[model samples]
Target: MEFTFLFSQFMSGLTYGLMLFLVASGLSLIFGVMNILNFAHATLWLIGAYICFTFWSLMEAHQFALWVSIPLAALATAATGWVCEVVLIKRIYKRELHEQLLITYAMALIFGDLIKIVWGPTDRLIVRPSIIQKPLFLFGAPIDSYFIFVILIGVAVAVGLWWFLKYTKYGHIVKAAVYSREMVGALGIPIPKIYTWVFTLGIFIAGLAGGVQSAIGSVTLGMDMNIIIQAFCVVVIGGFGSLMGTLVGSLIVGEVFSFAILYWPDGAMVLIFVITAMILIVKPWGLFGTPLRA
Candidate 1:
């Protein structure tokens, strides 16, 4: 019985960690390729959730509403990300770091307000499909069926991203840009266009994460604020631009938080910070990240 309980907790932590990976992977990719820190990333994610909810609500009578809405929300959010990159982010490429930070931070506030205007203050809930409505037993442990789906999606995404980064031409370009954007530009690659597509791809992943999250719980205002901080932590711990690092860091955080809550509920967050602090002290560049060029 005790083993079963522990297994369930471990599974829960894994689920949470993968969810963090989904959000943080895009964040890491953008920062790695463009050297841009996007404060509005989570807000865009929230928009994706709301968009999914709206789409699902429109076709609530159909059992297939949710399956269709998730991808649609992702595409819509990707479009928004593309526009923001071209209109606002493009102007800041050569600006000072402080200027870039200020712009992205302001965008976050603006996007947050836009969300309120469009979705109002009411919390939105997704009516899950009948297929995932019940619990599944695994070795005498009852697990949420939806969680199994979440786990599978997370694993699939992780594997898919790894394959893309390892085998594709654009992936090689992205990797090279990460090491030295100047070199990539010198090679005649359009840096600005690459930046735009990378940003859009990052936002698309975030949107997919958001759409998945909406089915997990009620989508409420200010949720982005919470997740964004954690997402940053994930990037920092995993090492910005290192996909495997992000995955490892996310699992560490998720597992620590899950188990810590059971033993020390009030200190779970503090414990996470403590661990993060330790990692930063030992390796400023993060566990998997290489030092930045001077």
Candidate 2:
């Protein structure tokens, strides 16, 4: 019984960790490549969830509601991201960090308000589609099939990203731009275009996170702020702009939250900060983070 209980917790933690990784990876990628700390990221996620819910509700009679809603919601969020990058973010690249933060933070507020206007004050949820609604028995335990699907999606995303970065030409350009934007530009590459792409990619991933999250819980007003804190912590502790670090940090935060909630319900949220502080005390730059420019 003890072993089975532990296994259940482990699976739960792993499922949640994949979602965290999905969200954190985008933030890390944006920060590493474009040096933008996008405060609007979680807002994009919230919008995604709301959009997914809306779409699913509209198409509830459809047999493939989940499949239809997810991509549509993600595309909507990506369009929002594209507009932000092309219009607002493009103009602010040379601004101070505080200025960038303030603008993005304000955008987050705007998105929150927009969501309220559209979805109202009610908490929304997207039910797991009937296709994956049944529980799968594993190790004498019934596990949610949707959770398993989410985990598999996360793994696929990770592997896809790795392959894209390693084998694709644009990926190579992005990497070069990361290390030396000036050099890449000097070599006739359009660095601004790259930044736009990076921003789009970042928020697109955030949107996907939101779409996935719709299956797990309520899409409430403050959901943006809720995940943003942990996303920031994950990136900071795992090393800013490090994809693998985001994965590691997500696992740490997710598992810590899972176990801590089991052991000390009140401290579940607090323990993540405790772990972040400990990691920073030892390696101030984060486990895999490169030194930042002063």
C-alpha TM-scores of all predictions: 0.97, 0.97
Worst window of 10 by summed lDDT in candidate 1? 285-294
User: Global lDDT of each model?
Assistant: 0.91, 0.86
List clashing residue pairs in candidate 2: none
Model 1 residue 156 lDDT? 89
| Model 2 agreement with the true structure over 191-265: per-residue lDDT tens digits | 899999988988888888888889887788997786889888888789996777888889888888888889999
Q: In angstroms, give how far residue 72 of model 1 lies from its true place.
A: 0.7
**lDDT for 212 (candidate 2):** 82
**RMSD in angstroms between candidate 2 and the native structure over all alpha carbons:** 1.1
Best candidate, lDDT: 1
TM-score of 2: 0.97
Clashing pairs in 1: none
Measured on C-alpha atoms, candidate 2 has an lDDT of 0.86
